[model samples]
Target: METIAFFNLKGGVGKTTSAVNIAWHAANEGIPTLLWDLDPQGAASWLLDSKAKSKAQPKKILNGKTPIGNLVKPTNYQHLDIIPADFSIRDLEQQLQLQSEQGQRNLIAKLIEPFSENYALIILDCPPSFSLLSEQIFDTADALYLPLIPTHLSLRTFEQTRDFFKKNKLKPKRLHAFFTMVDRRRSLHRLMLAHPPKMLKNGLPTPIPYAAVVERMGDHQAPLPAFDRNAHVSKAYASLWQDIKATLSDF
Candidate 1:
Protein backbone atom coordinates (compact mmCIF):
# COMPACT_ATOMS: atom_id res chain seq x y z
CA MET A 1 0.00 0.00 0.00
CA GLU A 2 1.13 3.52 -0.65
CA THR A 3 1.37 5.71 2.44
CA ILE A 4 0.91 9.49 2.16
CA ALA A 5 1.79 11.51 5.20
CA PHE A 6 0.15 14.96 5.16
CA PHE A 7 2.59 17.04 7.10
CA ASN A 8 3.84 20.62 7.58
CA LEU A 9 5.95 22.02 10.41
CA LYS A 10 3.70 25.03 10.76
CA GLY A 11 0.16 24.47 12.01
CA GLY A 12 -3.16 25.99 10.84
CA VAL A 13 -2.39 25.46 7.20
CA GLY A 14 -5.38 23.16 6.66
CA LYS A 15 -3.14 20.08 6.64
CA THR A 16 -5.64 17.81 8.36
CA THR A 17 -8.48 19.08 6.19
CA SER A 18 -6.59 18.27 3.01
CA ALA A 19 -5.60 14.85 4.33
CA VAL A 20 -9.20 14.00 5.24
CA ASN A 21 -10.56 15.12 1.87
CA ILE A 22 -7.99 13.22 -0.18
CA ALA A 23 -8.31 10.02 1.82
CA TRP A 24 -12.08 10.27 1.70
CA HIS A 25 -11.99 10.62 -2.07
CA ALA A 26 -9.75 7.56 -2.37
CA ALA A 27 -12.13 5.45 -0.30
CA ASN A 28 -15.05 6.76 -2.34
CA GLU A 29 -13.33 5.35 -5.37
CA GLY A 30 -13.58 1.91 -3.71
CA ILE A 31 -9.95 1.85 -2.69
CA PRO A 32 -9.46 0.33 0.75
CA THR A 33 -7.97 3.20 2.72
CA LEU A 34 -7.00 4.08 6.25
CA LEU A 35 -6.33 7.54 7.73
CA TRP A 36 -3.86 7.42 10.59
CA ASP A 37 -4.42 10.23 13.05
CA LEU A 38 -0.81 10.74 14.04
CA ASP A 39 -1.49 14.24 15.28
CA PRO A 40 -1.72 14.27 19.05
CA GLN A 41 -4.61 16.74 18.86
CA GLY A 42 -6.89 13.98 17.47
CA ALA A 43 -8.57 16.33 14.95
CA ALA A 44 -8.63 13.72 12.21
CA SER A 45 -9.92 11.11 14.63
CA TRP A 46 -12.63 13.49 15.73
CA LEU A 47 -13.64 14.19 12.11
CA LEU A 48 -14.04 10.50 11.31
CA ASP A 49 -15.50 9.53 14.67
CA SER A 50 -13.01 6.71 15.17
CA LYS A 51 -13.16 4.76 18.41
CA ALA A 52 -9.53 3.80 18.94
CA LYS A 53 -8.65 4.41 22.55
CA SER A 54 -5.24 5.55 23.73
CA LYS A 55 -4.18 5.88 27.31
CA ALA A 56 -2.94 9.12 28.80
CA GLN A 57 0.42 7.42 29.21
CA PRO A 58 1.53 5.42 26.20
CA LYS A 59 3.80 2.53 27.00
CA LYS A 60 6.13 1.97 24.08
CA ILE A 61 4.17 -0.58 22.08
CA LEU A 62 7.50 -1.67 20.63
CA ASN A 63 8.97 -2.18 24.08
CA GLY A 64 5.77 -3.68 25.43
CA LYS A 65 5.23 -7.42 24.99
CA THR A 66 2.16 -7.07 22.77
CA PRO A 67 1.34 -6.94 19.10
CA ILE A 68 0.66 -3.45 17.65
CA GLY A 69 -2.52 -4.26 15.72
CA ASN A 70 -4.45 -4.36 18.97
CA LEU A 71 -4.25 -0.60 19.24
CA VAL A 72 -6.00 -0.02 15.91
CA LYS A 73 -9.65 0.96 15.53
CA PRO A 74 -11.90 0.96 12.51
CA THR A 75 -13.92 4.03 11.50
CA ASN A 76 -17.44 4.41 10.12
CA TYR A 77 -16.46 5.02 6.51
CA GLN A 78 -17.20 2.19 4.13
CA HIS A 79 -13.80 1.69 2.58
CA LEU A 80 -12.03 4.25 4.76
CA ASP A 81 -10.74 3.19 8.15
CA ILE A 82 -8.81 5.11 10.81
CA ILE A 83 -6.55 4.47 13.76
CA PRO A 84 -7.61 7.27 16.08
CA ALA A 85 -5.27 9.49 18.06
CA ASP A 86 -5.21 10.07 21.79
CA PHE A 87 -5.49 13.59 23.12
CA SER A 88 -2.72 12.70 25.55
CA ILE A 89 -0.13 12.23 22.81
CA ARG A 90 1.99 15.02 24.32
CA ASP A 91 2.97 12.52 26.97
CA LEU A 92 3.60 9.87 24.32
CA GLU A 93 6.22 12.15 22.81
CA GLN A 94 8.08 12.39 26.09
CA GLN A 95 8.18 8.60 26.38
CA LEU A 96 9.34 8.32 22.77
CA GLN A 97 12.34 10.53 23.57
CA LEU A 98 13.78 7.82 25.80
CA GLN A 99 13.30 5.26 23.03
CA SER A 100 14.89 7.55 20.42
CA GLU A 101 18.07 7.95 22.48
CA GLN A 102 18.62 4.17 22.33
CA GLY A 103 18.79 4.23 18.48
CA GLN A 104 16.94 0.93 18.23
CA ARG A 105 13.33 1.81 17.58
CA ASN A 106 10.97 1.55 14.61
CA LEU A 107 7.68 1.19 16.32
CA ILE A 108 5.26 3.06 14.05
CA ALA A 109 6.51 1.34 10.91
CA LYS A 110 6.30 -2.13 12.39
CA LEU A 111 2.90 -1.44 13.88
CA ILE A 112 1.45 -0.21 10.58
CA GLU A 113 2.38 -3.18 8.42
CA PRO A 114 -0.81 -5.18 9.00
CA PHE A 115 -2.95 -2.54 7.34
CA SER A 116 -0.79 -2.50 4.23
CA GLU A 117 -2.12 -5.87 3.18
CA ASN A 118 -5.70 -4.62 3.18
CA TYR A 119 -5.40 -0.98 2.25
CA ALA A 120 -4.73 0.52 -1.16
CA LEU A 121 -3.75 3.75 0.57
CA ILE A 122 -2.90 4.85 4.08
CA ILE A 123 -2.96 8.58 4.91
CA LEU A 124 -1.17 9.76 8.01
CA ASP A 125 -2.29 13.07 9.56
CA CYS A 126 0.75 14.26 11.46
CA PRO A 127 1.10 17.04 13.99
CA PRO A 128 2.85 20.31 13.12
CA SER A 129 6.26 19.76 14.69
CA PHE A 130 9.79 18.72 13.85
CA SER A 131 10.23 16.00 16.42
CA LEU A 132 11.25 12.36 16.66
CA LEU A 133 7.64 11.37 16.01
CA SER A 134 7.70 13.38 12.79
CA GLU A 135 11.05 11.75 11.93
CA GLN A 136 9.58 8.29 12.33
CA ILE A 137 6.65 9.39 10.15
CA PHE A 138 8.90 10.53 7.31
CA ASP A 139 10.89 7.32 7.58
CA THR A 140 7.74 5.30 6.99
CA ALA A 141 5.83 7.42 4.48
CA ASP A 142 6.01 6.55 0.80
CA ALA A 143 4.97 10.11 -0.04
CA LEU A 144 4.32 13.40 1.69
CA TYR A 145 1.68 16.05 0.91
CA LEU A 146 2.33 19.52 2.21
CA PRO A 147 -0.66 21.92 2.43
CA LEU A 148 0.59 25.49 2.28
CA ILE A 149 -1.03 28.88 2.28
CA PRO A 150 0.15 31.63 -0.05
CA THR A 151 2.08 33.55 2.53
CA HIS A 152 5.65 34.63 3.15
CA LEU A 153 5.82 33.02 6.59
CA SER A 154 4.64 29.61 5.36
CA LEU A 155 7.28 29.58 2.65
CA ARG A 156 9.95 30.53 5.19
CA THR A 157 8.98 27.59 7.38
CA PHE A 158 8.95 25.34 4.32
CA GLU A 159 12.54 26.43 3.50
CA GLN A 160 13.71 25.70 7.05
CA THR A 161 12.02 22.31 6.97
CA ARG A 162 13.72 21.45 3.69
CA ASP A 163 17.10 22.53 5.02
CA PHE A 164 16.58 20.54 8.20
CA PHE A 165 15.71 17.40 6.24
CA LYS A 166 18.71 17.84 3.96
CA LYS A 167 20.98 18.33 6.95
CA ASN A 168 19.70 15.06 8.38
CA LYS A 169 20.43 13.30 5.06
CA LEU A 170 16.84 12.18 4.58
CA LYS A 171 15.46 13.00 1.17
CA PRO A 172 11.67 13.11 1.40
CA LYS A 173 10.78 12.81 -2.24
CA ARG A 174 7.14 12.96 -3.38
CA LEU A 175 6.82 16.11 -1.35
CA HIS A 176 4.17 18.14 -3.14
CA ALA A 177 2.59 21.47 -2.21
CA PHE A 178 -0.98 22.63 -2.85
CA PHE A 179 -2.68 25.93 -2.10
CA THR A 180 -5.46 26.06 0.50
CA MET A 181 -7.90 28.56 2.01
CA VAL A 182 -7.56 30.67 -1.05
CA ASP A 183 -9.52 33.89 -1.27
CA ARG A 184 -9.69 35.00 -4.84
CA ARG A 185 -10.93 38.39 -3.74
CA ARG A 186 -7.59 39.16 -2.16
CA SER A 187 -4.76 40.49 -4.33
CA LEU A 188 -2.22 38.28 -2.55
CA HIS A 189 -4.21 35.15 -3.36
CA ARG A 190 -4.62 36.27 -6.97
CA LEU A 191 -0.90 36.88 -7.32
CA MET A 192 0.00 33.47 -5.89
CA LEU A 193 -2.47 31.73 -8.16
CA ALA A 194 -1.41 33.56 -11.28
CA HIS A 195 2.30 33.08 -10.73
CA PRO A 196 3.02 30.55 -8.00
CA PRO A 197 6.56 30.58 -6.66
CA LYS A 198 8.78 27.64 -7.61
CA MET A 199 8.51 26.31 -4.09
CA LEU A 200 4.68 26.03 -4.39
CA LYS A 201 4.33 24.94 -8.02
CA ASN A 202 5.70 21.38 -7.77
CA GLY A 203 2.21 19.86 -7.92
CA LEU A 204 -0.91 20.06 -10.05
CA PRO A 205 -3.32 22.93 -9.64
CA THR A 206 -6.94 22.42 -8.56
CA PRO A 207 -7.08 25.02 -5.85
CA ILE A 208 -9.55 24.51 -3.02
CA PRO A 209 -11.19 27.89 -2.60
CA TYR A 210 -12.06 29.17 0.84
CA ALA A 211 -15.55 27.71 1.05
CA ALA A 212 -17.95 27.37 3.93
CA VAL A 213 -19.08 23.88 3.02
CA VAL A 214 -15.77 22.37 4.04
CA GLU A 215 -16.47 23.26 7.64
CA ARG A 216 -19.80 21.44 7.48
CA MET A 217 -17.88 18.26 6.78
CA GLY A 218 -17.37 17.72 10.47
CA ASP A 219 -21.04 18.33 11.24
CA HIS A 220 -22.16 15.91 8.54
CA GLN A 221 -19.54 13.38 9.58
CA ALA A 222 -18.54 12.91 5.96
CA PRO A 223 -16.43 14.31 3.16
CA LEU A 224 -17.33 17.38 1.10
CA PRO A 225 -18.75 15.38 -1.80
CA ALA A 226 -20.46 12.89 0.42
CA PHE A 227 -22.13 15.71 2.30
CA ASP A 228 -22.91 18.07 -0.57
CA ARG A 229 -21.71 16.95 -3.95
CA ASN A 230 -22.74 20.18 -5.59
CA ALA A 231 -20.76 22.38 -3.24
CA HIS A 232 -17.92 24.36 -4.84
CA VAL A 233 -15.43 22.98 -2.33
CA SER A 234 -16.57 19.45 -3.10
CA LYS A 235 -16.01 19.96 -6.81
CA ALA A 236 -12.57 21.45 -6.19
CA TYR A 237 -11.56 18.47 -4.11
CA ALA A 238 -12.89 16.17 -6.82
CA SER A 239 -10.74 17.85 -9.47
CA LEU A 240 -7.65 17.66 -7.27
CA TRP A 241 -8.22 14.00 -6.43
CA GLN A 242 -8.66 13.26 -10.12
CA ASP A 243 -5.26 14.76 -10.85
CA ILE A 244 -3.71 12.79 -8.02
CA LYS A 245 -5.19 9.56 -9.39
CA ALA A 246 -3.78 10.23 -12.82
CA THR A 247 -0.34 10.91 -11.32
CA LEU A 248 -0.43 7.71 -9.27
CA SER A 249 -1.47 5.55 -12.19
CA ASP A 250 1.34 6.95 -14.31
CA PHE A 251 3.75 6.24 -11.46
Candidate 2:
Protein backbone atom coordinates (compact mmCIF):
# COMPACT_ATOMS: atom_id res chain seq x y z
CA MET A 1 0.00 0.00 0.00
CA GLU A 2 1.10 3.57 -0.62
CA THR A 3 1.22 5.57 2.61
CA ILE A 4 0.61 9.32 2.61
CA ALA A 5 0.78 11.52 5.69
CA PHE A 6 -0.73 15.01 6.21
CA PHE A 7 1.58 16.87 8.54
CA ASN A 8 2.78 20.33 9.52
CA LEU A 9 4.92 21.47 12.46
CA LYS A 10 2.49 24.35 12.67
CA GLY A 11 -1.22 23.74 13.26
CA GLY A 12 -4.53 25.25 12.08
CA VAL A 13 -3.59 24.89 8.41
CA GLY A 14 -6.39 22.57 7.22
CA LYS A 15 -4.23 19.47 7.64
CA THR A 16 -6.98 17.22 9.03
CA THR A 17 -9.60 18.65 6.70
CA SER A 18 -7.46 17.93 3.65
CA ALA A 19 -6.65 14.45 4.85
CA VAL A 20 -10.34 13.63 5.47
CA ASN A 21 -11.57 15.05 2.15
CA ILE A 22 -8.81 13.40 0.14
CA ALA A 23 -9.51 10.06 1.76
CA TRP A 24 -13.19 10.46 0.95
CA HIS A 25 -12.40 11.20 -2.69
CA ALA A 26 -10.18 8.14 -2.95
CA ALA A 27 -12.82 5.93 -1.36
CA ASN A 28 -15.50 7.36 -3.64
CA GLU A 29 -13.37 6.20 -6.57
CA GLY A 30 -13.51 2.60 -5.23
CA ILE A 31 -9.97 2.55 -3.83
CA PRO A 32 -9.72 0.87 -0.46
CA THR A 33 -8.47 3.62 1.84
CA LEU A 34 -7.53 3.61 5.51
CA LEU A 35 -7.21 6.84 7.47
CA TRP A 36 -5.31 6.60 10.75
CA ASP A 37 -5.86 9.59 13.00
CA LEU A 38 -2.54 10.07 14.79
CA ASP A 39 -3.38 13.42 16.29
CA PRO A 40 -4.17 13.37 20.00
CA GLN A 41 -6.83 16.05 19.50
CA GLY A 42 -9.04 13.60 17.55
CA ALA A 43 -10.26 16.22 15.09
CA ALA A 44 -10.10 13.84 12.14
CA SER A 45 -11.87 11.19 14.13
CA TRP A 46 -14.60 13.67 14.97
CA LEU A 47 -14.92 14.74 11.35
CA LEU A 48 -15.36 11.12 10.31
CA ASP A 49 -17.79 10.45 13.19
CA SER A 50 -15.55 7.64 14.42
CA LYS A 51 -14.42 7.37 17.97
CA ALA A 52 -12.16 5.00 19.87
CA LYS A 53 -13.89 2.39 22.03
CA SER A 54 -11.67 3.19 24.95
CA LYS A 55 -9.27 5.93 25.95
CA ALA A 56 -6.45 3.42 26.47
CA GLN A 57 -6.59 2.08 22.93
CA PRO A 58 -3.82 4.25 21.54
CA LYS A 59 -1.41 3.42 24.32
CA LYS A 60 -2.18 -0.26 23.99
CA ILE A 61 -1.60 -0.21 20.26
CA LEU A 62 1.65 1.68 20.67
CA ASN A 63 2.88 -0.77 23.31
CA GLY A 64 2.06 -3.70 21.05
CA LYS A 65 -0.52 -5.02 23.46
CA THR A 66 -3.40 -4.46 21.04
CA PRO A 67 -3.60 -5.35 17.38
CA ILE A 68 -4.01 -2.23 15.31
CA GLY A 69 -6.29 -3.98 12.85
CA ASN A 70 -8.76 -4.79 15.59
CA LEU A 71 -9.37 -1.11 16.08
CA VAL A 72 -10.22 -0.44 12.43
CA LYS A 73 -13.81 0.78 12.10
CA PRO A 74 -15.75 1.15 8.90
CA THR A 75 -16.87 4.64 8.02
CA ASN A 76 -20.24 5.77 6.58
CA TYR A 77 -18.59 5.83 3.17
CA GLN A 78 -17.84 2.61 1.35
CA HIS A 79 -14.27 1.36 0.89
CA LEU A 80 -13.13 3.61 3.70
CA ASP A 81 -12.10 2.66 7.22
CA ILE A 82 -10.56 4.55 10.11
CA ILE A 83 -8.43 3.88 13.16
CA PRO A 84 -9.64 6.60 15.43
CA ALA A 85 -7.47 8.43 17.93
CA ASP A 86 -8.13 9.81 21.38
CA PHE A 87 -6.41 12.06 23.87
CA SER A 88 -4.32 9.09 25.00
CA ILE A 89 -2.32 9.36 21.79
CA ARG A 90 -0.52 12.31 23.35
CA ASP A 91 1.59 9.73 25.17
CA LEU A 92 2.83 8.21 21.92
CA GLU A 93 6.26 9.77 22.19
CA GLN A 94 6.72 8.45 25.70
CA GLN A 95 5.51 4.99 24.68
CA LEU A 96 7.90 4.84 21.71
CA GLN A 97 10.83 5.84 23.87
CA LEU A 98 10.08 2.99 26.23
CA GLN A 99 9.73 0.31 23.57
CA SER A 100 13.14 -0.70 22.13
CA GLU A 101 16.26 1.41 22.32
CA GLN A 102 17.44 0.68 18.79
CA GLY A 103 14.19 -0.16 16.95
CA GLN A 104 11.77 2.19 18.62
CA ARG A 105 12.29 4.83 15.96
CA ASN A 106 10.92 2.54 13.26
CA LEU A 107 8.02 1.21 15.27
CA ILE A 108 5.45 3.10 13.20
CA ALA A 109 6.83 1.67 9.97
CA LYS A 110 6.62 -1.80 11.42
CA LEU A 111 3.06 -1.25 12.60
CA ILE A 112 1.93 0.00 9.20
CA GLU A 113 3.63 -2.75 7.19
CA PRO A 114 0.95 -5.42 7.58
CA PHE A 115 -1.83 -3.19 6.19
CA SER A 116 -0.48 -3.42 2.62
CA GLU A 117 -2.54 -6.54 1.96
CA ASN A 118 -5.81 -4.81 2.89
CA TYR A 119 -5.53 -1.19 1.82
CA ALA A 120 -4.54 0.39 -1.48
CA LEU A 121 -3.92 3.70 0.21
CA ILE A 122 -3.22 4.61 3.84
CA ILE A 123 -3.48 8.20 5.08
CA LEU A 124 -2.02 9.35 8.36
CA ASP A 125 -3.33 12.56 9.99
CA CYS A 126 -0.38 13.57 12.11
CA PRO A 127 -0.20 15.87 15.12
CA PRO A 128 1.19 19.38 14.84
CA SER A 129 4.56 19.14 16.55
CA PHE A 130 8.15 18.10 16.00
CA SER A 131 8.58 15.16 18.31
CA LEU A 132 9.75 11.56 18.35
CA LEU A 133 6.38 10.56 16.89
CA SER A 134 6.88 13.01 14.02
CA GLU A 135 10.25 11.43 13.25
CA GLN A 136 8.61 8.02 13.05
CA ILE A 137 5.98 9.45 10.69
CA PHE A 138 8.72 10.92 8.45
CA ASP A 139 10.41 7.55 8.23
CA THR A 140 7.19 5.62 7.65
CA ALA A 141 5.20 7.68 5.12
CA ASP A 142 5.89 7.38 1.39
CA ALA A 143 4.92 11.04 0.94
CA LEU A 144 4.33 13.87 3.39
CA TYR A 145 1.80 16.59 2.50
CA LEU A 146 2.45 19.87 4.25
CA PRO A 147 -0.54 22.27 4.35
CA LEU A 148 0.32 25.82 5.28
CA ILE A 149 -1.46 29.16 5.29
CA PRO A 150 -0.17 31.80 2.86
CA THR A 151 1.81 33.78 5.41
CA HIS A 152 5.45 34.60 6.11
CA LEU A 153 5.53 32.58 9.33
CA SER A 154 4.06 29.56 7.58
CA LEU A 155 6.64 29.84 4.79
CA ARG A 156 9.39 30.03 7.38
CA THR A 157 8.03 26.88 9.02
CA PHE A 158 8.07 25.10 5.66
CA GLU A 159 11.69 26.14 5.12
CA GLN A 160 12.57 24.94 8.59
CA THR A 161 10.98 21.57 7.85
CA ARG A 162 13.03 21.25 4.64
CA ASP A 163 16.22 22.18 6.47
CA PHE A 164 15.45 19.65 9.16
CA PHE A 165 15.08 16.93 6.56
CA LYS A 166 18.30 17.96 4.79
CA LYS A 167 20.25 18.16 8.05
CA ASN A 168 19.03 14.70 8.99
CA LYS A 169 19.85 13.29 5.53
CA LEU A 170 16.21 12.50 4.77
CA LYS A 171 14.72 12.99 1.30
CA PRO A 172 13.32 16.52 1.16
CA LYS A 173 11.57 15.59 -2.09
CA ARG A 174 9.08 13.59 -0.02
CA LEU A 175 7.52 16.90 1.04
CA HIS A 176 4.67 18.35 -1.09
CA ALA A 177 3.32 21.62 0.27
CA PHE A 178 0.14 23.46 -0.71
CA PHE A 179 -1.53 26.68 0.38
CA THR A 180 -4.60 26.55 2.65
CA MET A 181 -7.05 29.23 3.85
CA VAL A 182 -5.99 31.57 1.07
CA ASP A 183 -7.89 34.86 0.95
CA ARG A 184 -7.42 36.70 -2.34
CA ARG A 185 -8.49 39.98 -0.72
CA ARG A 186 -5.20 40.00 1.20
CA SER A 187 -2.39 41.31 -1.03
CA LEU A 188 0.18 39.06 0.62
CA HIS A 189 -1.95 36.00 -0.01
CA ARG A 190 -2.64 36.98 -3.59
CA LEU A 191 1.02 37.73 -4.29
CA MET A 192 2.19 34.42 -2.85
CA LEU A 193 -0.47 32.51 -4.75
CA ALA A 194 0.48 34.21 -7.99
CA HIS A 195 4.24 33.79 -7.56
CA PRO A 196 5.43 31.48 -4.81
CA PRO A 197 9.03 31.21 -3.68
CA LYS A 198 11.62 29.12 -5.57
CA MET A 199 11.29 26.31 -3.03
CA LEU A 200 7.54 26.14 -3.68
CA LYS A 201 7.89 26.04 -7.46
CA ASN A 202 7.28 22.28 -7.29
CA GLY A 203 4.35 22.63 -4.88
CA LEU A 204 0.85 21.52 -5.68
CA PRO A 205 -0.99 23.75 -8.17
CA THR A 206 -4.41 24.07 -6.47
CA PRO A 207 -4.83 26.35 -3.47
CA ILE A 208 -7.81 25.98 -1.10
CA PRO A 209 -9.76 29.20 -0.65
CA TYR A 210 -10.94 30.50 2.70
CA ALA A 211 -14.61 29.65 3.12
CA ALA A 212 -17.18 29.14 5.86
CA VAL A 213 -18.28 25.95 4.11
CA VAL A 214 -14.94 24.38 4.93
CA GLU A 215 -15.51 25.06 8.61
CA ARG A 216 -18.94 23.44 8.37
CA MET A 217 -17.26 20.03 8.09
CA GLY A 218 -17.46 19.84 11.86
CA ASP A 219 -21.19 20.57 11.84
CA HIS A 220 -21.86 18.06 9.08
CA GLN A 221 -19.50 15.50 10.57
CA ALA A 222 -18.46 14.56 7.06
CA PRO A 223 -16.18 15.47 4.17
CA LEU A 224 -16.69 18.57 2.02
CA PRO A 225 -18.06 16.57 -0.92
CA ALA A 226 -20.45 14.65 1.27
CA PHE A 227 -22.08 17.85 2.45
CA ASP A 228 -21.75 20.23 -0.48
CA ARG A 229 -20.03 18.86 -3.54
CA ASN A 230 -20.60 22.00 -5.61
CA ALA A 231 -19.24 24.43 -3.05
CA HIS A 232 -16.16 26.38 -4.16
CA VAL A 233 -14.02 24.94 -1.36
CA SER A 234 -15.31 21.46 -2.12
CA LYS A 235 -14.43 21.83 -5.79
CA ALA A 236 -10.96 23.02 -4.85
CA TYR A 237 -10.53 19.96 -2.64
CA ALA A 238 -11.58 17.71 -5.51
CA SER A 239 -9.04 19.34 -7.80
CA LEU A 240 -6.44 19.09 -5.07
CA TRP A 241 -7.10 15.37 -4.77
CA GLN A 242 -6.59 14.94 -8.52
CA ASP A 243 -3.29 16.79 -8.27
CA ILE A 244 -2.20 14.61 -5.38
CA LYS A 245 -3.04 11.41 -7.22
CA ALA A 246 -1.08 12.57 -10.27
CA THR A 247 1.86 13.58 -8.10
CA LEU A 248 1.89 10.26 -6.28
CA SER A 249 1.89 8.47 -9.63
CA ASP A 250 5.36 9.88 -10.35
CA PHE A 251 6.65 8.21 -7.18
Question: Number of the top candidate by lDDT?
Answer: 2
Q: How much is the lDDT of residue 70 in candidate 2?
A: 78
Quote model 1's TM-score: 0.89
Query: How far off is residue 135 in model 2, in Å?
Result: 0.5
Error of 2 at 175 (Å): 0.4
Tens digits of per-residue lDDT for model 2, 1-251: 78999999998898999999999999999999999999988999999999876644666676678777877889999999998985365476677776656554488888888898899999999999998788888878888999979999999999998899899988998899999999999999999998898988658999999999988999999999998999999999999999888767632
Badly placed stretches (over 4 Å) of model 1 are 54-60, 246-251
- Give the CA lDDT, 0 to 100, for residue 227 in model 1: 69
Residue 201 lDDT in candidate 2: 62
Cα lDDT tens digits, model 1, 139-212, are 78776777778777877887776677677777734566778888899998899889888765456588888988
Candidate 1, residue 157: Cα displacement in angstroms equals 1.7
